[model samples]
Target: MAAPEPSSPAPDLPLLDEHRIAIDAPRDRVWAGLCRWSDTLGIGDRHPLGLLLGTQPRRGFERVELVPERVLGFAGRHRFSRYRLTFELAEITPVRTQVTARSNAEFPRLRGRAYHALVVGSGAHVVSVRRMLNSIRRESLKD
Candidate 1:
């Protein structure tokens, strides 16, 4: 099925992070890794639950946009937070590509604010995002 409409924050949401990596593979190969959930949890944008809306916690993000090798975006929210993650690709060379992962999110209410504090304020989120980008780079380079 086609991905849902492009996803973005409500403008009031904060910019969580913007991480970039240069990969040896071409954009197409890198794009494949963007679509992979296990391979890149940072870009988990294709799970069925991501699109299904309910009060139940969601394990993944629904695809909000796809532009071939240029962009892949998704948004999903659980009880504590609502967030959007986007991977933007740029061709650096015939055999190389640059991928940037940008995240925007908001944690509302008292509990949500606390959840954000524990997760985002602890530096864990940044570390995990970097690790995820590296994982994608490694996965894409594999033969």
Candidate 2:
């Protein structure tokens, strides 16, 4: 019998969305906030369409890459969108960090493409990104 093909860890995807924000918090503090916030995505995020369709916040993706307080990345499939989200943190001062969030994604079929167009490409993704940044800022400032 022939051996089966090795499974790929993640599919190579195309760039879809990217955004950045500066946080007045230390890199380590922001990193800690990010880790905690990632697990709480679905708890309070509720899109109007999502509510109409009963879409729940997705489970957190596994951290595919990590560089301590500098970089963090994750890739996964949500609904029909296969994508990656990476966070890059640069320290600008003793208590400030510039953070960038980059997203790369691929919609394999018509349904996925439509979902991305309606939800992501229509500027909702931007809102979502900003909310995420605010969450990080809030968490990082906590004692």
Candidate 3:
């Protein structure tokens, strides 16, 4: 069967956003560290949303969708959206790994666009998601 369609409109924001970094450590070491839920815990400090949502404590995986060297998907909560965020490992080479996050919530529209336009943007949400992605990358590297 084909995948189901999304209910909401394609987020007016960038969806498949990504960042690539060359960690000082080897890919396996980085992958090992990245794979752990503990590594992700409290890493929100770098995220722009983190500043607003605060740090999330380490919680064990309630469900494990996929696990292996090449890909890993799981459900967990973050500070802003209380939804399951999936991290997909796209590429894992000896030198580096590529990962992406996918989630859709009205929080961005609420706290981000709607709030900003009415209060800050005049009618548009000006929050920079690129900055958020960069923050995630920085936090990921610290481990």
Candidate 2 matches the true fold with a TM-score of 0.75
Residues 1-143, model 2: lDDT tens digits: 23223222253567666777778888889888877876765433444544444332334344576777877777655556666777888898978898888877777689887988888879898898888878877887788
How far in Å is the alpha carbon of 60 misplaced in model 2?
5.1
Point out where model 3 deviates above 4 Å.
1-26, 37-64, 74-82, 107-143
What's the candidate order when arranged by decreasing lDDT?
A: 1, 2, 3
Instruction: Give the whole-model CA lDDT for all candidates, comma-separated.
Output: 0.74, 0.70, 0.42
Each prediction's RMSD to truth: 4.6, 6.8, 8.6
Which pairs of residues have clashing backbones in candidate 2? none
User: For model 3, how many clashes?
Assistant: 0
**Residue lDDT tens for model 1, 31-73:** 7876674333422244654444332224455667777778877
Q: Rank the candidates by TM-score, best first.
A: 1, 2, 3
Cα lDDT, model 2, residue 13: 64
All candidates: TM-score: 0.78, 0.75, 0.39
